[model samples]
Target: MRAALLCSAAGSLLLSTLTAAPATEDRTGAAEMRGTAVAAARAKAAGVDFGPCPDAQDLPGRMQCGTVSVPLDYARPDGKRIELSVSRARATRKDPRRGAHTVPRQGALLYSPGGPGATGLYFPLIGLLPEWKRIAAAYDLVGYAPRGVGRSAPLSCTDPKRFFNGPSPAPTHPSEAYKRERVAQAKAYARGCAERAGDALRHYHSLNNARDLDVVRAALGEERLTFMGSSYGTYPAALYATLFPAHVRRMVFDSVVHPDPARIWYRNSLAQSPAFERRWADFRAWIARHDDVYGLGGTAWEVLRGYERASAKLAAEPAGGKVGPGQLQGAFLQAGYYDDQWPHRAHALSAYLKGDAKPLVEQMEQHPEAAVEAENSRAVYVAVECNDAPWPTDFRVWDRDNTRLARVAPFETWHNVWTNLPCAYWRVPRQRPLDVAAGPGELPPTLILAAERDAATPYEGALELHDRLAGSVLVTERDAGTHGLAGGPNACVNGHMEAYLLQGRLPGRHAECAPHAEPKPTAPGSRAVGRSR
Candidate 1:
């Protein structure tokens, strides 16, 4: 799995120079240039037959499910087709009017939720929220599991335990032997994926994912698409827009990724280090504010010292024989992702420091059977990211970069490197990433959201995308650090998102919204705000 995707605890703001525009005509001219592929795809999509979802009783709302058969290799549409599982909740209001801009009731509002491996089948549930009810009422809320993900011929490596439950990426010390072990493990992981997934691995790149989206668009009988994507999900969403510019109606890319061709996976992971460090400082300050309740420390530095001490102690003697230093770090990493998780994480740490291990132990424990599912996610994450672009081949290059980064951003630098180390040994051939830059008047107005201090996909990435995509509006959540800004706690961000989705309104120019207030100390026995990421 891409470490950047997994490091997201929960899951940014800015404005570009671009402005909103009227929807463009479907680029039938471009479609014609693609020759018979477009017609063939349309014919196949017309034949799709939707039925009751597999777990209709379990899923929310009136969620119907179906599958569309797309070619494993789009170049050969008639050959080796793969079924992509799709779910939909039809719009409630047949006609939704917003001001003078009444949205025509057509096409589905498709969404991709970050993780290259995250299943989108359940994402339509977001449409049920009161704030998003208007959107659901105007368009079908659509979600689909990308190829190699859940229910879509899910791929996996041979050894589940060996891949998931192995040594921590960040060892306390980087000895020569440890480096060798990591290298061997990475090679083994790469070999396992190639041996297990075979030719399927080659077809799992982001381009194929974009192509798959078009097939879904054709199947839905819609001329254009409206999309919302976050984290790694933004890459595919943007790529789809680039490939089929005229087919895009509206797009929301939150916590945007920098689509730098040279730094696709490797350098992107490195960029998160400093961003995570900034978030870590913010978390420490929050803990200090509640020192009276948790008794961890009275200053940010003090709180950090306490955490380091506790981590070292756990490294020596793990709590409840399970929550070691690595597990402790993993649990606390959530705090940097979302402010809502701070209280719970602080309470857990306080309890562990006072010799109670239940909270820490419970947080780290996983069901034994979940390893298979985890490996499946990992398999897809690796396939898409590794196949999308090249990673450094030399272990020494990675070691050098990580070692330098760990000096200042120790929180996630080394761990992130190991999380992505397998890419260096990937068996699939790398393809040059698509040029994601959109020419002037080529794409519909896009809303780009970014936090000032996002850790997973840094704030700078949002700026990069804003500059590249012409006619896009950038919305910044000033000083906020959470990932996946839209549908989050901030009404300011969500308001703009809803406006664009419902009425196709873009901010006049670049804009910024105030961050939500941080949580205060709660009385003992009262529940915390709970996890937000």
Candidate 2:
């Protein structure tokens, strides 16, 4: 999920001075189909041509992979089409428990890994983990590359090497000049995407993604949608349920996007700025507590000073030349998502200050080939975000809003703004934001999880989504801030999730999980997701 956003920028310092299409082409009349509805009622869903999965050898069940073709434009239904890569980890049996359960296991659990851009063809592989055991037993875990992501008509905006691996500007204080630079690069990137993507940009937003998702569901021959998605993935999943509510059996949205139509995406993206700032504060405070281990600072302010000094050193002479100031900040961003990363990253910073550049440099390494995938992720992220709804055409609105926000909560504010700045110059028609509150028919009980302190999809979203979707359950992870709560460290949350998926009901409509333990000094854990550029 971190990689979904962190790497989607595709370029670290992409800036210049400052950084949408029309109606009538009516492809978004495609959106008139509701994010992913098949406007042509008679259009038959394509069948998936299942074959052996390349990476399924390690899993217990026979994992199958195939491609399903869907309409490139739902409005044009049968006129043209695109492919979606699909995977299925077949459900072998129900829970072989010593516990008594009478309800029959339900249908496939269509899964997306939280990216409006993240590659998800392999998500079914999560069933191999112990945490997913009962889930795997009760349902066929279905995974697919949502439209314009990964192998499914993937979007590409610019040359990968230049956009992803090129040098970034110094992470110095934002001056007028620095702000102008970001604007220029943002325009350049947006223009590049429009020039490169052309007509294809019109078909990649959430509505079309939703339309394609239902086509995939039909291809799998499922009568109802039982789904699980994280972060931005929840947006389309919610749309699918709304677009085709009668077909919705069950759903689990982990770290969800708010669906008030008012928050569509621009406001949603901006909301993350402050959340990241608070999470960063938590990391700094954690560093302060572990001063005995890190010896960098005894207070949060002192710790931030240590980081600033390190950022300055890296800006002048990048550790190992590859890990620059951008790389340093990228490393710090990980602590905003997962607290367990605090110790290792803090140590890496400490080592860099002591002249052990290898720790930080190695932490920031990237294989050259990865740049292409990063470009695809970024392209889809840009296309979807920009195309999902209208953005401020006037750069001043962007400039004012971001400037006001950054002044108070500086962490990630500018970096995040530049990443999505392409939206201001989008080349395709922007759809009216999808209304995900209700479906054509009654919606099923949904399980939405969010950590109170989660920066990616803030707790407000979960609360809002719970309010909009009547009878849905909202589970809070108290005092914790991690994203992607399903199968996470909190057993209480996981327990609620597992019980919901397997038995189709939770103990209560509203629940909360206590915070998971924080990490010990130097404890090895999850790696930082994505990197600078």
Candidate 3:
């Protein structure tokens, strides 16, 4: 878990007036010269060959896979190198619309699925979806596993079973003994990562990942890169835009990450606490509205009480000897991520409360203990997040903040704390986070999408990013709670994205779109799903 309003034209004008003009070297002629130099460098570097995709054989369309080698440390390019896995689905249309930028005819639409650690090798599949089919027809949809993720030299610490099956972060009884145990677990996690990853961890920061993206761009023979970054993916994407504005043609950021340099991982978690609580409340209300089917309660508070009791029961006696209080919370946390999941989650909760533990246990089963690939993903996630910026080393600071947060937003506060605790003890040297503020006209216009009530990446972050990325347009999904908004069911948001990607057009000012009506309760035994966009 990680974590805007429209501004008037007058405000936009004021921002543009305050921004500094590009340097003399950043003018058109100089930019073209720089691009030529980059192309020459790319020509000298190792080239990629398109072949059948190794991981996903069933993916629709003509998918090609290749690898590009980038220096592990740009400062010592010849010292060490790592390969990043890349995949692309070529455009289906013969005559694709071109943007106004004077770059090698609008290249592929590159996408990054955020996780800081999430493997993006398969994200091109999104373009194959019916809603995005048209966009896919125009531009090749490209995806790559960022360094330290998936096939790109993944990072791993302890065995997945040992790591995931350890003590719960949220103790039923917050005794001193419980606190000590949690701290011990966090320390062990940090030590294990240090021992397992060693020097590799030092190279897993976001800046390095952004640099890697540039190499991918060059290897693809693209003079300009068009990208869509979601969730945690926004950090590197934003960094890419900041470092190489001349290279970017169009970019879209969804479920935006706040680009605050000081508050990277720790503070970001704290910000998500209230957002999770709010989403949890919404879930409770939804369940209450369907009391006839769930029979959990008739009021939100009543529903919450039932949930607390269930959690307590699971803590005392793990369901099917696997699903415990923490596991239960983890399962429900998905509800916070996407409202489309509410129906299944509600049904599962109803089944659990009605003395049938099978559904709950099934949900727990979804979180396997020995999935090495998943463990690798977590490792890379921690590696990038913990090393990207400084985290408070003092346990007392964590204890105090979490204790206070637990009082008002107990839903995911402590769980989130423990999830990020390893960062406090990360061995890698911290890097100063980038000051992402862009001057007016410094970069091409970008599009931003956010939901008003997203829990993972709260709505406030999108607004902050929109303000920082001068000339950017923020398209809001009013009352929506989903994390990634573009590829989902919201035609309003998707339509805007299509317009920007196909034609270099964005809203004249900040805009908002209403979400679909909340899911109505379905009749018992019906399999209708309430979709969320």
lDDT of each: 0.76, 0.75, 0.76
lDDT of 3 by residue, 1-533 (tens): 22211112212322322212122222132433344345337633656797888855576648889988777666555557778899988776643344332223356888877887777778677665677776877788889999888889778878877656732434633777777887887888888889987877787888777777777787877778899899998888898888889889899998998787645666667778878888999999989988998888999999989988888888778888877788788878878998777777777777788888887786565355447777888888888888777677767777766676667778887788777888777766766677787779889999999999998988878888998888999999998798898868888998899899988899865989899567666544556465433
Candidate 1 segments whose C-alpha is farther than 4 A from its true place: 1-40, 43-48, 94-106, 161-173, 522-524, 531-533
Sort by lDDT, top down from the best: 3, 1, 2
Better of 1 and 2 by lDDT: 1
Q: Which scores higher on lDDT, 2 or 3? A: 3
Q: What TM-score against the true fold does each predicted structure earn?
A: 0.89, 0.89, 0.88
Summed backbone clashes in each candidate are: 10, 18, 1
Candidate 1 residue-wise lDDT, 460-480, digit = tens: 788888988999999999988
